[model samples]
Target: MVAYGFKRWFSPQIQDGTKTHTIRGHRRRHAHQGEELQLFEGMRSLHCRKIIPDPICVAVLPIVIISSDLIDCGIAYIEIDGLPLHRDEIEPFAVSDGFSPDRLRGIAPAALVASTARETMGRFWRSTQPGSRFEGVLIRWRS
Candidate 1:
């Protein structure tokens, strides 16, 4: 399973089905339809303090959003079917991972990055050091 990590603040949006697509900063690995992705909390002290060892959700990658840029180096949109983790189930795992609930307060929304995808993005993220290359890549769903 491909594993992706996100910040804690954004977990609620994923859980509630408000946020559908994740706009990645750089193009990572190619994601196929129906691929299962494990979503966990990343360890970024600035955004989220707690590092949720266990994945907060499992999602299937159904679509990948493309961009109009001539030189697109990163994925534009990552559509997922995310199922939020229950607090009861996650608490035990959190403790085992060396984090306590008390330390998780007031964090920003979590960002997600698939494991394999992370490798690809990591390269780009490092190359573009000192500044984030995240641009606006919007995908509009048609009903």
Candidate 2:
């Protein structure tokens, strides 16, 4: 099974069926739909220090790419079948596309657009430079 690793803070959101979509750098080869993804935590920090063995969450969810855009930079929205998690709950640090305020305004409703500037939801509009090959991927989480 294909496995993806996330930070400790965000991993639980996935396991609990809270965060359904993950926006990330695009992948040259995407995981096929209906494939079970092994969820791992602390993989990013594993190279830095020898931490305790991280437990692998048994929850495997099917994911799909629901949206892709190449305007400012390439981005893919992957959707997972799980309970919807609002942006406030996750509390992202920064918005990936904050540089393009107009884009955010255009796509999101006026109310949402207004909230994008607030601290809680600001990260959603934050600018994130696209990766060399792939912009990003949105992974949908499924219970």
* Predicted candidate 1 versus true structure: per-residue lDDT over 58-83, tens digit per residue: 23233323222233333232222233
Whole-model lDDT values for every prediction: 0.35, 0.40
TM-scores, all candidates, are 0.33, 0.41
For candidate 1, report its TM-score.
Answer: 0.33
What's the C-alpha lDDT at position 140 in model 1? 17
Worst 10 residues of 1 by lDDT: 134-143
Candidate 2, residues 1-143, lDDT tens digits: the string is: 45566544444445444455444554555455566555565566645332223222333344332222342222223234444334352223124213123334544444434443333133332333332222345555465
Query: How does candidate 2 fare on TM-score?
Result: 0.41
Could you say which candidate leads in lDDT? 2
Candidate 2 lDDT (Cα, whole model)?
0.40
RMSD of each: 14.7, 10.7
